[model samples]
Every structure is written in C-alpha cells, then in structure tokens.
Target: MDHVIKTLTPAARPPEAPGEVPAAPLRARPSRAEAEAAVRVLLGYIGDDPDREGLVDTPRRVVSAYDELFGGYHENPGEVLERTFSEIGTYDDIVLVRDIPFASHCEHHMMPFVGRAHVGYLPVERVVGLSKIARLIDIFAKRLQTQERLSSMIVTEIDTVLKPRGVAVMLEAEHTCMSMRGVQKAGSRTITTQFTGVFRDDPKEQFRFVSLVRNGIG
Candidate 1:
C-alpha cells in the first residue's frame, strides 16, 4: 500500500567546512534620511508646501509609521513555527480558524488593506497552537503587500511549516488605495483564496473548509 505522509524532509547538509566563523548578528535598519527626502520631493511635486508648520514634521512621522507598518520584513517566519504539540487520538477532522483580522499596507499606494483571514489545515501527525496561526498572519501582514499575494503567502507558510495533508486560506479585505482614491468606491471588498494538497484536488473538502469558516461548524 502506498503511504500518504506529510513529514518534513531532512534538509540537505551543507558541505563540510573547517573553522567556519560565526556570522555576525543582524544590524539595525538603514537610516530613513533617503525616504524622508523622497517624501519631501513628493510633497513638492504634488503642489504641497513641505515647509509649512502642518507639513514640517510630516516626513518624520511617515518614516516612523512605515517602520512599524512594514516591520514583518525583518522577522523570520520559520522561527514562529518552530514549536509544536502532538495530538494523540483517532480524531481527524478539519481544523478551521476564521475571522483573524489583520491590517496591511498596500505596496502600490501605501494605503491600508484591512481584512480577516480564514485558515484551515488537516492534521497529518501534529497540530500547531491556535495563537501561532494568528501570529503567522501578523508576521506576514505587517509587510507591504497586495491581497492576492498575501493570501497565497499565508497558505504557503502554513503548508511549509506544518506539512499538513491539506491547507486552505481565504482573505476578505477592503483596499483603501482603491476606495479612498482612484475608483473611489467604498463598501466594496476583495476576496482571495489559496488551497493545496487534498484541498486542491477535492472540491468537497475545499467547500467544507469554506463553509466552516463562513458558518461555524456548529
């Protein structure tokens, strides 16, 4: 009988080296002077006076805000998934968590794409703690992104870290870049989804996962 396993394969060993020096700790981020200058230029190009009192500190505030908004660029996602707990039982049903809210900055217009994510995975041998899923979402969402890429990134990260038999991710969001400007249509939401393994091949499984997220299992 062919076995369907979802275990993490051992990574290939690096070539044996003699006396490899320890790598240096990561250094602090580069100065924001360049970004500040860019902001000043943008303000002038947009016919706004940058030297006015109201706009005097705007560049500095924007620089500081961007650091927090895109802090995920500095985080290591694998470390977030390093710890795990094994579950013992014959019980194997879809584990779904829904309505995980996140706020991400749009890479295109630097506006916000606020949304909720629904994530599900079929356990192969172990289960991750619930909070970790939310943490993973936050880790990825804090970076500049678009809804489609963000949805796929969440699904791929969970698949890589957990090696689940199946994984599904759905995101529902409002893109302020579109609503607050350009098209200027509020109340319109964007939905993006990604699936893999059994969830990709089995429509029923995918539907079930979606139903559970949209409507509670109860």
Candidate 2:
C-alpha cells in the first residue's frame, strides 16, 4: 500500500495583486513570428538552411519548444511556497524527499543536464506539500543553470519559505554538453551540494542526510 501523507495540505499560491505581473505569463507578449525569425537567424549562423524542406518549420518548432522549456523564467519560485500549514503540530526531525527528477540546460553550452535532486529540511514551524518541492525544483531547473546555483537555490527557497531549522539539497547529473561533445567523457557525472542552518552547524546531521540519499532512501 502506498503510504499517503494526507496530513500535509496543498499549499496555496496566492494570486498576484491588480496590475501585478503574473508569476508566469501563459502567452508571450511578443508575436510568435518574431521568435520564429530569431530562430531562423540562429540556424543560419550554424550553417543550416532555414528554408530547406527538412528545416522549413524548424525555426517555428524551436520557438514553441523554447516557450515550454524556459517558461519558468516568467514565474516566481517564491510564490509556490506562499501558503503554509502547521497542523502537524511538531517540528524536530529532518524531512527528506529524494529522486526528484529534473532537466535543465547548461548556461555554458545550452545543452541538457538531466538529473535527480535530493532535498531535506528540518521544519521549524510549517511544511509544504511534496508536489510543491518538485515545483520548486522546476522553477530553478527550467532556466539555463549551473548545477551549483540550482542546488543553492533549492536550499535557499526552502529556507526562506519554510523557515526551516536547516535545509540541504544535493544534485547529481550527467551534462549532455560534457558527455556528447567537445572534451567528451560519456559517463561523467557532476554532483553539487548545498546546506544551510542546522545542516551547516551540525556535521553529523549533514552526514546522515548524505548517507541516506546515497543509499537510495525515498
């Protein structure tokens, strides 16, 4: 049986005020044709003919994918954590969620970095639903990112929103830019870690979190 934790409520994401910018605009302000034109120039610079039958719609397709891939840019991560619930009535031990899948484009190469994130936090007063944790990952991962910054942002956001006693985030991934081209090392993986609050102050707690994640705990 799946152990469902229904006690954890879905956190409310408050709507932006009047005249406020939406966290993410579903529609792009600029016309799609302009985006398509930009992609056409990019393909041309790469020595590809944008007008060729095989490549004719490539520009438009790229623009469409770009809209989905970078949609996080228009969204605020903080808003995902705006509402909190404290009915659990306890705050002492670490809360761990592992194998949170994510995909990102490397800022350096614009190539894909696919990986899993392991997040742990010691709640001080409140908690958020598990889905929100994944949403947090999306907010940072959907942008061009360095793994280091991504890990740091996860911890920072959790710290800010939950006011946790401590937070820890670890990401391990293989970058397509590294594995598939240039100085290719096909199986190479990068791991990044960030810790704050109690996790930083207590080495034992930090080690426990790391060990558990490495051992494949959920």
By TM-score, who's the top model here? Answer: 2
- By summed lDDT, the worst window of 10 consecutive residues in model 2 runs over 1-10
Instruction: Determine the C-alpha RMSD for candidate 2 after optimal superposition of all C-alphas.
Output: 7.4
- In model 1, which runs have C-alpha deviations exceeding 4 angstroms? 1-30
Question: Candidate 2: which pairs clash?
Answer: none
User: How far is 2's C-alpha from truth in model 2 (Å)?
Assistant: 28
The residue-by-residue lDDT of candidate 2 on 179-216, one tens digit each, is 99998898889999999898999999889999889885
TM-score of 2: 0.83
Clashes of 1: 0
Over the full model, what C-alpha lDDT does candidate 2 score relative to the true structure? 0.80
Residue 21 displacement (Å), model 1: 29
Assess the local accuracy of residue 62 in candidate 2 as a C-alpha lDDT between 0 and 100: 92
Global lDDT of each candidate: 0.80, 0.80
Per-prediction TM-score to the true structure, in the order listed: 0.81, 0.83
